[model samples]
Every structure is written in structure tokens, then in C-alpha cells.
Target: MATAPTASNLPLFYKDLVPLSSVDHADFHARPLDSADFLINQHAVPLTSDEFVSASRHYPIVFSAGDNPVPLALMGLNEGINTFVSEEGKLINPVYVPAYIRRYPFMLARLRPDTDELSLCFDPTSGAIGKFDEGDVLFVDGKPSDAVNNILEFCKNFEEAGQRTGQFVEELQKADLLMDGEVSIQADGYEQPFVYRGFKMVDETKLRELRGDVLRKMMQNGILALIFAHLFSLQLMREIFAEQVKAGKMPAVTVAPTTA
Candidate 1:
């Protein structure tokens, strides 16, 4: 099956992306990411399987639509509505921030479709990045600085986590446990309930019917807990919808009964 494009398919908040080559970006430096307002417009963020435990505590974790499903942490139900991010871009909730977000402005990318090699890249348009008089330098004496090395390490870790997440999804797919998910919420004074769709989720019935050996293997590998975390997080969808209503940012759409 062909893979579907994900929210992270292209680097978000990246206006201009250039490979961090010593010859090209020799004088580049990176300023501290002091604020998170950049994430305010992001309604959903990609998540690695490792983030399920902590992410489930705050955002609802669901699978993105695609052949190779990627987990997503939903900050809000509607577009341009990140309930966790304040107007100031500060995170309103004290929850585990996904590594995908923390590694922003810096990520590993394949410059060409034909190549398997990944390069360290950064968003040149980000004001936080530049060759300013004061900031962490990207290279020292033509060599990568400690700060640059640290960023590389973080991106490497993120890539590894993504691979693990892919394996988890593959296991679920092999078991045929994923199904289209929907949720309905009732708001006061609203005659009909708001229904949301277009996301994938684990089917509890199929999961419960798995072979004993398969279930034990999943438990031993800790995938079972992650699955449960995702299931439990679905309840937060209603809460996120309520937050949108409270903030008066809910999109104007007709409410309809949920389909089976």
C-alpha cells in the first residue's frame, strides 16, 4: 500500500529549508527557542509510540489516515484551533511535549526522492536561526559545535523513535485492528450533537479477539499499554471540543448524527 501524506510530511513552520552543510551554512547560528507560539496554529502534531503514555494524559492520540499510519496528538478538533497553546504561544497544559515539536526548526530530511541518505536541515526563515553576534554557533573552526552536535543527536533520537512507532503500527495492521473512528459531543443549547470523523483508531473488539500468543507478545513488548493509552485518550476529544466552544473558535458546521 502507498503511504499517505502526514502533517509532518513537510516540515511545519518552515518557510525555507536548506541543508545544514558546513560549506553553505558555515556562519549560521541558532537562537534559543524561547516561545512556543509557533505551534499555536497546529491542531494536531505527530507522535512517536514512546510518547503514548505521557501524551495520552493530555491530548487524544489517534492514527492519521494512510497506508502507513502515523500517530497524532490532537490539540484540538478543528483546524487552526490548538486548545493547549495560549494566545501567547505558551502551552496551557502541563503535559509531555512530543519530541516532534521540540525538534522543530531542525529535522532530518532526504533532499531527493531517489536518495536514501538523510541530511540535517533547518528552517532558514526562522528568526531564531541566523549568524547573529550572539547565539549558539552551528560550526566552530569549520567543525560542528557542541550545540550543533546536540541538535543532531536529538534528530537522530527522533528518527529512531519514529521507526519504533512504524513497527508498532505494522503490528497493529498485521492484526487488522485498526478501524475508522468517530466521536460525538453534545453542547448546551445545541439541538444536535457535533460529530467528528476522518481518523483511524484501534478496534477494541478485534484487539480482544487476538490470539493469546499475539496478545502476550504485544504485552511483553509494551505495545498493549500504548494501545490502551490511545483508547483512553479518545475521551479527551469531548473535552477538547468543549474548550473550542468555550473559546468561541468552533467552526460553523451543521451537526449530524454519527454513522455506524
Candidate 2:
């Protein structure tokens, strides 16, 4: 029998997830968000396989019919918003986010390319979220009447926040830090002639079929591979922690872990 990989061996475990070649913007459009589509369509994600197994094995919160069902629009919007606050952190400094990433444990997040025009999916059986570059922006998973306007508003916010994040990451790229890296940035939000420090940000809206082009490239390279990897890592982290507890390697926490 083979021994399972542990946290100590996690660096090797995740090494395979990295691309053998540089992941360029062109490649991202083709792949269009790695494993995220499998877990949930552009419209909905019921529960992951691991989530289902975990839920079946443990008790979770239950509600009555009178209780309101969780709004999918809110769920989706909240996901983006949470990522913004977490990854970008109010844009205090263009360099803060990347600096934080190097100093601490942070979750990874990805948004499909703006040009793809793909949005929302809902199959009670297999929910997903992706781009639809060919069509006018439409929320298909649920009724646009139900979540379309909401998601559009969220999309606008997402674009704005993404630009800010890009600015932050750009600063990191210019820094001398040993771990400095370039974040995947899509020129989707830059509109109007905006000049900062004598450099003009390209107007993404003017690019014909740019979002679709970006989406196509992403699909080729493995869409949102890093984000999905982080999600899977969370699951692995739990498994490793549980195993460590069983082996009496560390004490369990009664209070929540402190955060900065």
C-alpha cells in the first residue's frame, strides 16, 4: 500500500499543477477556467463531490420551507466581492496585495475573461459559470429577471476592482522582491483616455471581440487553474490537519485563528 501525501509533501503535490510553458493571456481564453466549469456551470454549483461526501457524513444547518432560499445572485456577487476585499484590500497601496501574498496564506481567485460574453449557468444537476463571448451578455443559469441585473452590476464592480488589483500587481512586478510575479490581467475595464504617470491604459471596450478572444486563450491554458488549485488545497489542508490531530502532532484550536 502507498502512503498518502501529507502537508510536508504538499509542495511536490502541487508542482504538477503548474504549467510546463508560460501561461499567456492567449492561452487562458482557450481553456476558459480550468476545473471550475466541472464543479458548477456559469449558472449554479449545487455541491462539489467532496462537499456532498462531507455533508453526508456530518450534520449541517437545516432550514424550514418558510425560510428564504439562498439567493444565487447574491451568492455569486458575494464571491467576487469577497475576492476583491481579500485580494486587493481597498487598494490602500498598489503593492500591498502582492506583498501580503508572499507574507501570508491567501486564497486564489479568478474571473473569466470579459470578452467571452459567457455568464451564469444553472442546472440543478450540474451548475457552472463561464464566458459566452458570441452573444450579448445574458445570465442563463437562472432567470435574468432573477439575477441578470444583479450580476451585471456585480460585473461592473468586478471590472473596476480588477483594474485596481492589476495596478497593485503591476507594482509588485516592478519591485525587487525575489518572489515578484505577474498576475494575469485582461485589458477589459480600461475605457476613456486615462493617463497616469505619462502612461496610458488601453481602452479595453474599443477592442472588437476582445473578451471572446481572451476567453478562448484562457480555455487553452487551463482556465483559473491556480484558483481551483487553492480550493482543492483547502480540502487537502483539512485532511492534513485531521490526520495530524489523530497522530497527536498538534493541539486542536478552540478559538478561531488570529488574522491581521
Candidate 3:
């Protein structure tokens, strides 16, 4: 599973980022996405902690393997395979799309590395923002239009949710609750169980052994609910695997050579 982009790494689905400006794009209008083809091959998408409750219902919410692990919603068991999305970029299953996907083509990003200030930016290659005659206007009379204001509001909310997500991950790390994750599925007629790895998850064993006060505090603060949501979502892994099989995207089995 792939993690979200860092300062040095390019964000998924974005080829190039440019700050949105009223001056440079007075006549530009942001068009609604016509298709979800961009997500057709994306098996996993980043998730903010605030999205756990909603996203967990449809996709398995697991963490990336690293020191600062971020949450991710798995759409398929294997890389570059998305069973939920169709060839035409439509959803085969009417599932709750992650905010990370909804926020695509537009996001609030830092313009400089030294400062904390953020600017509204969009992916130029997205083809969503353009000088169209009929679409949401970006600017009017040298000022940002209502549409731009709305986008800014959404981006701000996303940023705030991202910060909260970071805090939730920190709490898990502090409690030593995260561990390397693995899932084993034995499909019918298969001699070997398919083992999947390369991700992380909350260690329920450690969680159950937490001290009374820590558990109480976590419960009161709503952290326990998130952990349970993640654990419950893990069951859907088999469902996704089944979907992949039905879609004919399941990887072929490799039988090891047996010595005489």
C-alpha cells in the first residue's frame, strides 16, 4: 500500500501544481469531473482520521508502514487494481468516497518550505480548471467568485481534518498500538492461502492490555471508537478479494517446486 505524498514527493493524481490566482485565471472556470478514470487504477487512497467512521464502512482502513504512518483506505488487495471503480471511471459499488479523492484537482498547499502559509492550488493536468464558457467561474471583476470561495472553504476544512488525523496517529504511536499488518485468505480450491502484507494496523493484543486510565481516557476522547472502526473494516478485506476475483484481476498462483 502506498502512503500520501511528502514535501519532496509528488502527490498522487497530480502531475503539476500551480497556485490558483484571480489575476492569472480571471476567465477560468472550474469544471465538474466528468469521469473518475483517474482513480480506476488506484487501489488505495489516503484517509484522514475524521473519515474513519464513514470510510471504514466500505473500505479497510489500514495505516502505511513507516515511522509516521497515515491512514489509508484499501480498494483492492493488490497494487494497481481497483475493483470498486469501473473501466469508465464510475463506481461499481456505491461506496462512500474518501475526502482525499473528493479533494482531488484542488488542495491547500504551502508555497514555501520555510513558512507555514498555505495557498490554494490545483492540478493543471486535471483538465478541471480551464477557461470554459459554461462552468463555475474562478474570478469575477478581478476578485474571487463565489465558486472560488467555496473551494477555499472546502480546502480549509480538509487541512483542518488532516491535522486532526495526524494527532490521532500520534496517539496510536505513543501507546505502541500499531504493528505490521498481514492478511491471509484461503480461496476455495486453492491449496495455498493468499498472504498479503506491506501495511500496518492497530495491535488489538496491545490495546486489550492497556492500563485502565489509558483505556478510559481513550474511550472518553473517542479514540477507541476509531480503533474499533479500523478493526471492523479489516473484515472487508475478504470482500475486496472476492471482488477482485469476480473481476478477473486476482493474481495467478505460483506453486513452489517440491524436492524429491
Provide the TM-score for each candidate, comma-separated: 0.90, 0.22, 0.94
Query: Which of the two candidates, 2 or 3, achieves a greater lDDT against the reference?
Result: 3
Best by lDDT: 3
lDDT score, candidate 3, position 215: 99
lDDT: worst 10-residue window of model 1:
1-10
Query: By how many angstroms RMSD does model 2 differ from the true structure?
Result: 23.4
Cα lDDT over the full model 2 = 0.24
lDDT of 2 at 237: 27
Q: For residues 50-136, what per-residue lDDT tens digits would candidate 1 score against the true structure?
A: 889999999899887656677989888866778998999887878788898888899999999999899899877767788788899
Which segments of candidate 1 are over 4 A away from where they belong?
A: 1-9, 254-260
Q: Candidate 3's residue-wise lDDT over 77-187, tens digit each?
A: 777789899899888878898988888899998999999999999998898888888889888899989988988998899999999999999999999999988888998
* Reference-based lDDT, each prediction: 0.83, 0.24, 0.86
What range of 10 consecutive residues in model 3 has the weakest lDDT sum?
Answer: 251-260
